[model samples]
Target: MPTDDLGGRGERIAAAYLTHQGLRVLDRNWRCRDGEVDIVAREGSALVFCEVKTRRATGFGHPVEAVTPAKQRRLRVLAQRWLAAHDEHAPDLRFDVVGVLVRQSGPAEVTHLRGAFT
Candidate 1:
């Protein structure tokens, strides 16, 4: 499959994984002027802005490692904008990272790291 296809598949898996973890998914692939958040879910009163990173291999490192400081800043900015537009009652917000490791065989492994960074 093409790389983008694999990425899309990974994102789907990550979303399902988060939902299974008891998060109410408010949005997926949410984009704003600053950036995009792969998954937006509510964990109790806190709104979570999630970044999904997937890789077939982790030779470099885990997928979450790819979320640089600049990326976190962008996510935070976008999350604020997202809340301003749709949420009537802006709740406490946090950032998360869903790391997906996809293999050719066997089931994929998804790791959800809450409050990964600022």
Candidate 2:
């Protein structure tokens, strides 16, 4: 599958997993001039901004490793933009990274790294 398609699939899987864990999804692929957040969710009283990274294998590195510090910074900026645009507020906030490993013969494996960055 194409990389973009794989990424979309991973986002879907990540959203489902988060929902199963009791997080209410607020947005998917939320974008702004700064960047995009793969998924936005509400976990109890905290707001969550998630980045989804998918890979066929770990040849290069674990999918989560792809979320560099720069990327995390961008995500934080984007989150602020999202909030400002929507005029929403949360008492607490979190950044999460979801790594999806696709397999040719079986279901994809998903790893959710919550509070990945400040």
Instruction: Please tell me which predicted candidate would have the highest TM-score against the true structure.
Output: 2
lDDT of 1 at 43: 80
Put down candidate 2 lDDT per residue, 24-106, tens digits, no spaces. Answer: 99999988878788999999889999999999999999999999999999999999988888855789999999999988879
**What's the true lDDT of residue 106 in model 2?**
95
Clashing pairs in 1: none
Tell me the whole-model lDDT of each prediction, alpha carbons only.
0.86, 0.92
State TM-scores per candidate. Answer: 0.93, 0.96
Off by over 4 Å in 1: 88-90
Candidate 1 lDDT by residue in tens digits, 1-112: 7889888998899888888889888998877767777888888888888999999989989998999998888887888788788943535778999899999899998888
